[model samples]
Target: MVEAARILFGEHGFHGTGMAQIADASGIRVGQIYRDFESKEDIIAAMVAADLSDFLDEAVLAQAIAMGDRQRVRRWVLDLMIRKQQPNDSTLLPEILAEASRNPRVAAIMREGDQRIRRHVAAALAMLAPHAESACARCVEELMMTLMMGGCSRRMALVEGDWQFLEGCMARFLDQQIAWLADHDDGAAAADHADA
Candidate 1:
């Protein structure tokens, strides 16, 4: 039912989609769908949750980021920049974001999803920089993530958008950030060696 709603919602937007239509798409009876879900809001929340579950597992990415693997981080960012262009799994993101403006529940779900990514960014900062807690690091990370999301939004707007442009932008951004991180790591290593 949720999958059917995702497709319908993507096609028709939230307001245009109806429970009966979702039932028809899923081949499930409306009565059963009502029994399964509390309300339309509940169904919407569940759909967002299920989508976010596969979106990004921060636990795994955080592990990779902490290990100072630049390629790992780059690959993840590259994947993100191009995700909307992929043939399968057409996202209902624009519709979701539209609903989020007026729907507190949807807004909260979106916030939770963005928060997870932000936490990973913060964690990576902590791992790579001696001054991760400083204002400068916070500012740079915020700028980077905001731009990354903008690139994602742009990609979704086009039928065959240029993923390579975003990828290149991210590559340069990562190179600059990673160089700073490496410098911090090197300084910390030198300090440890001197102490030894």
Candidate 2:
């Protein structure tokens, strides 16, 4: 049923697709879907959750862990914004966002997912900039993430190659972050003072 739903959902936006089409594609009796899922919305939510779980867990987080502090934070965010574009990865969240523009329920779900990703970004930044609290680090991380996201999309629209402009932007952004940290690195300052 889900396989059918995936195809139908992918082909048409969530609101445009119907359960009958899903049943037809699945070659299962339409009622069987009900036995498995309560409603179309339920199936949509389930499909979205299932599709996102693997990319978010494996490709995204694993990539972040392998990266350095600034790269980890940038990649952590880039992963969220582009995880859908990954080959063989589902674009469910983007679809959900589109659906949410008209659907309060879907909008709420996407908002919740957005919040989770924001927290994950905050955590990644905290790992990179441990001298700063989560709140402080997240402010910077969110700004960079938003910049990368908007920049990548615009760059992709104008460019034809697989561009990894993130590293250069991150380096520049990190330089700024480092300068700020140098001036306010209480931990390092305290250690220096203690050593003195």
Candidate 3:
């Protein structure tokens, strides 16, 4: 039932899919779905959680944590964003975002996911950026997320691998973030940035 909802939601979106259709796709009775999930929203919420955990797991997050160099952190941020910005991911996320906008329940789930990622990013910054707490840290985090969310939507529908441009943009954004951080305190920034 959960798998059915993911595919249906991923394909037709939350608004377009019906419980009956999901049951049919999953080869389960509609009533059986209710036994597991209270409503479509519940199912979608689970899917969102699963997706978030699946995408940003401990292994990947650990690498981000182990990194401490400013230039390296910037490159790592871009590389991570590029990897997560697969075409289908951006396409599916907007539908979820739009659904979230109309439904408070959905919005809550989305916001939770966003908060989790933000905290993860912030922690990574703190480790590699002991001296960066002001605008520079926030800007780095925001730019990385923005590049991921925006680039996914913009480049998802393209053919022939257009994400290379997004990779370049991410690299540039990282460079800017590094320079901005360096200006605050180069020695401390460099020391934290060089974490192996």
* lDDT computed for candidate 3: 0.72
**How high is each candidate's TM-score?**
0.76, 0.67, 0.78
lDDT, candidate 3, residue 50?
Answer: 83
2 against 3, candidate with superior TM-score: 3
Which ten residues in a row are the worst by lDDT in model 1? Answer: 81-90
**Cα lDDT of model 2 by residue, 106-145, tens digit:** 6676666656656666666555666764445656767856
Please, what are the lDDT tens digits per residue for candidate 1 over residues 1-196? 8888878888888899989999999999999999998767778888767755565555556667768775676666555434443332345777778889999987887888788667766665555554432555676578767775776676566556556775677778766875665555645666878999
All candidates: CA RMSD in angstroms?
4.7, 5.0, 5.5
Tens digits of lDDT, candidate 3, 1-196: 7877777777888788999999999999988888988888898788878877776664665765675445555454565577655335645777888889899999999899888877776765655556764677888778777766665665565545656775787677666666676566646656778983
Q: Any runs in candidate 2 off by more than 4 Å, and if so which? A: 58-94, 133-135, 144-162, 166-196
Q: What is the Cα-based lDDT of residue 196 in candidate 2? A: 100
